[model samples]
Target: MKICVFGTGAIGSHLAGRLAKGGAELSVIARGSQLAAIREKGITVRAPDGELHCMPRAAADPAELGPQDAVLVTTKQTALPSVAGTIAPLLGPDTSVAFVVNGIPWWYYDSEGGPNQGTRLPQVDPGDAMRKAVGIERTLGGVVWSACTVTEPGVVEVRSPTSRLILGEPDGTVSARAQAIADILKAGGLGAKAVPDIRTELWAKLIGNLSQGPLCVLSRQDMKTTLADPAVREAALRSLNESIAIAAGLGIKLEINAEDRFARSVNTAHKPSILQDLEAGRPMEVAAIFDLPLLLARQAGVETPTLDLCVALARQTAAAAGLYQA
Candidate 1:
C-alpha cells in the first residue's frame, strides 16, 4: 500500500515510521526544519523501548509526492485549514484519507443523522476547506491513542505505554480498505482495529478530550498535576458530565460513567495536545475539542453552564495566542 502521512510532525513521524516498518510504500509531507532534518536523517522514531528509522520520500509540496492509496493526517485540528490547500497532490480516485488526530472532525456530520445531520461547524472546519478538499466519499473515520511527540525536528518519541489506532467508515461499516489499513498498522506493532459505528467510538474518545483538554490548557499543567487539586477535579468532572449530556442528546452511547472517566484521566500524567500546542505557541483546537460541543449542546437544548464558562475562557486563550480563528 502506498501511504503518505501529511503534516508529519510528532504523531505523523511515529505513524510514518511504523508504516515503513510494516513494509508499505510510505512517504511523508513535511516542511521547514523538520523537512530538512528528515531529508538528512530519514524518519526516526524513538519509542520508550527502542527506535526505528526509515528514509521515506520527503517533500515540502504535495505535488512532489503525487497520488497515494491512503493519506493519514496526523496534524492537530487547528492546522487543518492551513494545510488543506496543499492536500490534493496526495489524492487519487481510490485514495483514502484518515484523520488520526483529536477532537471533533471536520467531516463529523457527513454520515450522521438527526436534526443536525450534514451540519457544518465553523469552529472546527472553519470555512469548510477540509470538507471541500477531502469530500466524505473518500473520508474515513479514524482515532489514534498513540502518545507521541516530536522531541525535536525529525525526531519522534512515543510517550505512552501502548499505541493503538481505531478506524471505521462513515456509514458504520468495516470495509475492506479499513481492514487493510488496520492490518498494516498492526504489522508495525501498533494495535489497530476496524470497527462498526465509528460515530459512537468518536464520541467515546471525545468525552475524554472535552473533559481534560480545557483544564490542562487553563491550568498550564498536565492532567495529573492539574487534577491533583480538589477544585480542578470537581471542574473536570463537571465538564465531563456536561459532555455526557451532550452526547446523550445526540444519541451517542457512553460505555463507562463520567466519574470513572475522570478518574482515568486523573491517573494520566500526560499533557493534552491542546496544552502542548499552547506551550509551543501553536494554534489551539478550541473548536473541535470544546466550542463545537457547546454548539451541539445548544442545539440539543442541553444546559451546559460550566461547559460554557470553560469554553469562553478557552476561546479567549486561543485568541490571545492568535491561534483561534473565526
Candidate 2:
C-alpha cells in the first residue's frame, strides 16, 4: 500500500515509521525543522517494544506526495481547515482518508443515524470544508491510544507501554480498507484493530480524556501529578462517571469502571495534549475536546457538573493566554 501521513508530528511520525517498517510505500507531509530532519535522517521512534527507524519521502506540500492508497491525517483539530484546503492533491478516486485525530471528529454525524444524524459541527469542521474535501465515502474514523511526543525533529518518544490504533467506517460496518490499514500497523509491531463501532471506541478513549484533560490544564500538571490528590482523584472519578452518563444518554453504553479508569490515569505521568498545547503557546483544543462534549451532554440531557466547572476554568485559562477565544 502507498500511504501518506499528513502532519509528521508525534503521532504522524510514529505512524509513518510503522508504515515504512511494515513494507508499505510511505511518504510524509511535514514542515519546518521536522520536515527538514525527516528528509535528512528519516524518522526515529523510541517505543516500548523496540527502536524503529525508517526513511520515507518527506515533503511540506501534499502535491509533492501525490495521491496514495490512504492518507492518515494526524494534525491537531485547529489545522483541519488548512488541511481541507490543501489536501486535494493527495486524493484519488479510490483513496481513503482517515482522520486519526482527537475529540469529536467533524464526520461524527455523517451517517450516525440518530437525532443528531446529519448535524454538522461547524466548530470542528468550519463551513463543512472537510465534508466537501473528503467525502463520507472516503472517510474513516480513527482513535489512537498512543501517548507520544516529538522529542526532537524527526524523533518521537512513545511513552505508553502499549499503543494501539482503532479504525472503523462511519456507518458501523467492518471495512476491508480499514482492516488493511490496521493489518499494516500490526505488522509493524503496533497494536491495531478494525472495529464495527468507532464511536463506542472513541468514547472509550474519550472517557480518559474527559477525566484528565481539563483538570490537568487547570492544575498545570501531568495526569499523575494532577490526579494524585485524593480529593482531585475523587473528582476525576466523578467526571468519568458523568462522561459515561453522557455517552449512555447518547445511546452508547460504555462498559468502563470509573475507579479503574481513574486509577490508570493516576499512574500516567504523561501530560494530556491540551496541556502540552497550552505550555507551547499553541491553540488548545477547547472547542472539540472540552466544549463539544459538553454540548453533547446538554443535548443528551446529561449534566456534567464537574466537567462544566473544570472546562470553564480551563477555557478561561486558554483564553487568558490568547490560545483560545470564546
Candidate 3:
C-alpha cells in the first residue's frame, strides 16, 4: 500500500514509522526541523515492544509525495485548515483519509443518523473546509490511545505499554479500506482495528479526556500527578459521570466505570496532550476537545454542570495563553 502521513508530529512520526516497518510504501509530509531530521535519520520510535527505525520519503509539501492509497492525518485540530489547503495533492480517486485524532472530529455528522444528523460544527470545521477538501465519502473516523512524544526531531518516545488505533467509516459499516489500514498497523505491533461503531469508541476515549484533560491542563501536571489529590480526583469523577450522561443522551451508551478508569491512571506519568500544547505555546485544542462537547451537551439537553465549569476554566486557560479565542 502506498501511504502518506501528513503532519508528522509525535503521533504522526510514530505511525509513519510503524507503517514503514509494516512494509507499506510510506511517505511523510512534514516541515521544519522535524522534516530535516526525518530526511536525515528517518523516524525512530522507542516503544515498549522494541525500538523501531524506518526511513520514508519525507517532504514539506503534499504535492511532492503525490497521490497515495491512504493518508493519515495526525495533526492537532487547529491545523486542519492548513491541512485542507495542502491535502489535495496527496488524494487520489480511491484514497482513504483517516483522521487519527482526538476529540469529536469535523466529519462527525456526515453519515450519522440522529436528531443532529447532518449538522455542521463550524467550531471544528469552520466553513466546511475539511468536508469540501477531503470529501465525506472517503473520510474515516479514528481514535488513538498512545502516549507518544517527540523527544527529538525525528525520534518519538512512546510511554504507553499498549497502543491502539481504531478506525471506522462514518456510516458505521465495516470498510475494507479501514480494515486494510488496521491490518498493517497491527502487523507493526500496534493494537489496531476497524469497528462497526466508531462513535462509541470516540466517546469512550473522550470520557477520559473530559475527566483528565482540563484538570491536567490547569495543574500543568501529568495524569498520575494531577489526579493524586483526592479532591481533584473527585472532580474528575464528576466530570466523567457528566460526560457519560451526555453520551447517553446522544444514544451512545458507554459502559465504563469512572472510578475504575481513574484508578488505572493513578500511576501514569503521561501528560495529557492539551497540557503538552499549553506548555509548548502552540495552539491548544480548546474548540474540538472542550467546546464542541459542551455545545453537544446543550443540544442533547444533557446537564453537564461539572463539564461546563471545567471546560470554561480550560477555555480561559487557552485564551490567557493567546492560543485560543472564543
The candidate 2 region of ten consecutive residues with least summed lDDT is 256-265
The C-alpha lDDT values of all candidates are 0.85, 0.91, 0.91
Top-down lDDT ranking: 2, 3, 1
TM-score of each: 0.95, 0.99, 0.99
lDDT of 3 by residue, 1-326 (tens): 99999988889988988888888899999999999999999999999999999889999988898999999999999999999999999999999999998888998887899877898888888899999999999899989999999998999999998999999999999999999999999889889999999999999999888778999999999999998999988898888889888889889989888778778877888999899999999999988888888888898889988888888898899999999997
Q: Per-residue CA lDDT of candidate 2, range 1-326, in tens?
A: 99999999889998888888888899999999999999899999999999999999988888988989999999999999999999999999899999999999999988999988999899999999999999899999999999999999999999989999999999999999999999999999889999999999999988788768989998999998988898888888888899899899999979888777777888989999999999989888889888999999999899899989888988999999999986
Give a tens-digit lDDT track for model 1, residues 1-326.
99999888788898898899888898988989999999999988988657889999999899999999999998888788876888998999999999887887877777776666787776777688988888888888898887777888898889888888899998778899888988998888788889998878888888888877877888889899999999879988998898888999888887877777777788898888888888888878787888787888888889988778877887788788898775
Superposition error at 171 for model 2 (Å): 0.5
For candidate 3, the 10 contiguous residues with the lowest summed lDDT are: 257-266
Q: What stretches of model 3 exceed 4 Å from their correct place?
A: none
Clashes of 3: 0
